[model samples]
Target: MFATESGGVRRNSLKDFVNVKANGKIAMKLADGDKLVRVRTCTEDDDILLSAHGGKCIRFPVTGVRVFVGRDSKGVRGIKLAKGDEVIAMSVLRHVKVGVEERDEYLAAVNAARRLKGGDYTKRAEDKARDEELAAKLNEEKFVRMAEEEEYLLTIAADGLGKRSSAYEYRIAGRGGQGIANIDLARGKKKTHVAAAFTVLDSDQIVMVSDSGQIIRCSIDKISIVGRSSRGVSIFNTADGEQVVSVSRLRDVNGDDEEGDEAEEVENGGPEAEAAPQGNEEGEEEPPEVDGAGEAEGDKAGGGEEETP
Candidate 1:
């Protein structure tokens, strides 16, 4: 995944990395008031979603965008934004093909099972039976296997409200189009808009940074999953005047091998993998500036206010 300040898309090649390391090459040229927000490795088969603060989202196939050789070139427009709107997040989605009708039926059955398992008795017995029938039908369908491997899109608003929507909710479209809604921020309890949207798993953890410089790391499963058009429940409790500006997906650090590797890296003063902070506005803390060789220029890793992303 790659994105720029002016909502442009570009694929930076390994040659670009070699050049940047060798001669400190420019990544992508940005327009006035624009900066490169993110660059991530992704396969051509993956889908990409660019989310804006205005609650608009665009999804396009990664293979559709051409890779440019020039680093200073302004890439093609990823999404058409409304005035005063800007891109906040770009996510690489796993490709999953499921018809809308099958998905809806499968989701209904899954939700019913969840409610039933939760001991919710409000649903009628007939509803449970129908759900079971749908489940049986879905089990025989090819979509069921794809559904098991499906990914979810986590969308959080500035107010800290968010939801886990199935990646399938976002249908892939051609580039530069006004996309569909990723979250329903307008009718929510709080009058807020999207701050970030990215793909996440149930086992994943995320770090959210507030405008007040507050940071919180929490489990992704704790946040409720809702429909594409529904407003999300609050995931972070932000104080008045504070808003979540950046959210990063944390890598899984549960296994003993992973823990040992991380401990070894820390002891050796080696850099650990971390999610790059996004939408870090003016006055917000930032990662230390790195030189052409990818070494921090002035700030140490544990220095005050400056940390690795």
Candidate 2:
């Protein structure tokens, strides 16, 4: 799967690259000034979520994109962008069939539980009783099932604020439509734009980099989970004139299987980092091998061969 910043998406089979050389082959032809933003492994049953810099996101089924037979052609539109808005991230999540009523009920229960866990004893008795009632209305088995399929989307703003929102808040819609608000852009005093938006696991760690070369790494669980359109709390504190430009998620490798562990080790170096031997016999350094495919800017096509889903 290849997703572009301009909302183009391409789906190709793994077998299509069976004979690909070390130089690599063109996975998808991109338009002028458009760059590939993601190359994640996905199944037909999964859903593709595209997040734009203007704080908008669209969710649609993977089946909405037809499997490409050639790599020279650009793919179909995954979302419609407003003027000057470009996609910042593309994430693939499991496709879960949840009704509107069920989703509302689950969210209510989850929010109530979160408030209860906060231990805010200063709340009025009626408010506490109402939260308890909402929590009790949730079916244990159904809640467990929803939890299994639930995904959290971590969205970061250029102004150093971020939050995790339930994926259920993003309703499934047809491809190539204007998306709903991903975050409240007007909630802050300073005008801000989305720096990064992608699905993350609670156990994952995130590293944020600012334009001033400042970096901050923290546990994903520390971020508060809030409504999709709500303004998030500060996750990073950028200095004056600085803005967050990049964010990366590091998976929890401790409990992974052998293959998963090896993959994570390779990913830590980055998608373009080669797995070749380090030094030569003379103890001198060797130049890294370059792939034939290149990006318009410095943005690397995310996920290398080992990361293919």
Candidate 3:
């Protein structure tokens, strides 16, 4: 897995990591004031989505990043930050090919369904016109199949309000461009920005933590799924003076798989590293040394190390 820092990224090989000493080795160097914020495993085909507290986001394919021989190089810019904005979260998504018109129609259908569920089914001429246009362009059977394979993104604000939006709500863009809004903050009485946003599954649960140390867990399915720009529902009730500090997805504990088990072993200092396969057909590898000037590593930060394939 790769841990994204405010200024750069730290990465280690999954195969060779098992052979390293329990103390761990240098992964990526960083700038003096920068620190790690997020970690995610990546594949060549995966797209990286970086979210900022200012409601802007950037998406770029993983292959766009260069694989450095050493951990010392400062990583490339993943997003163009506003004057005071900084990255708070990063998510990996599978690449999907779809037309813009089709995606728009799908979102319209979802929004209409949500409106009906919320008891706002009043008829409108424009709504009818849009639906008719959508019906003529989308194949019902094909759209249903795509929806079955689609993933939804859940974004929560510090004020305890949250929403689930289709993954397609975020369009893929080049690295370092000012991104589109991840959620609407001006919809309701309270004015607050997004605290956390990540991909979620219907069967998943979420744990929201408050600034006052209060924590609440809710089923992902219970949260109202809505349009990307719509106002969200209240998923957690914070104390009068409290605000949610963080939100995380929870999966079934019994559903742990091989990768999860490996992560656990690494966390507990298990000796599976000694048994882990070493260099492939090649012999002992040399320590990598990066030549360019970039973000420099600082004093160690507190966290367990992760190795990615």
TM-score against native, each model: 0.75, 0.79, 0.72
Q: Per-residue lDDT tens digits of candidate 1, residues 1-309?
A: 468645677765566667346557667666676766668788877888887766777788887565554566555667766566667777787766667786776677666656556644465788767666755655665756866778888888777888998776777777766667777766434456677777777877777888788888787888987787688898889997677877777665685234211110000111111212222111223333232222223524333222111
lDDT of 2: 0.72
Q: Could you tell me which residue pairs clash in candidate 1?
A: none
Q: Residue by residue across 167-253, what tens digits does model 2's lDDT show?
A: 999888877677778887774446577877888888887778887889887878999999998889999998776778778777754
Q: CA shift at 86, candidate 1, in angstroms? A: 0.5
State the displacement of the C-alpha of residue 160, model 2, in Å, after optimal TM-score superposition.
0.7
Q: Write the candidate numbers in order of decreasing lDDT.
A: 2, 1, 3
Residue pair clashes in candidate 2:
41-309
Pick out the ten consecutive residues of candidate 3 with the lowest summed lDDT.
264-273
* Top lDDT prediction, candidate number: 2
- Worst 10-residue lDDT window for candidate 1 reads 261-270
lDDT of 3 by residue, 49-140 (tens): 77666566666666645454345544555555555455667788887777888788777776655454444326776766665565443358
Pick by lDDT: 1 or 3, better one: 1
Error of 3 at 28 (Å): 0.7
lDDT of each: 0.65, 0.72, 0.59
> What are the runs in model 1 whose C-alpha is more than 4 Å off?
187-190, 213-215, 255-309
Q: What is the lDDT of residue 308 in candidate 3?
A: 16
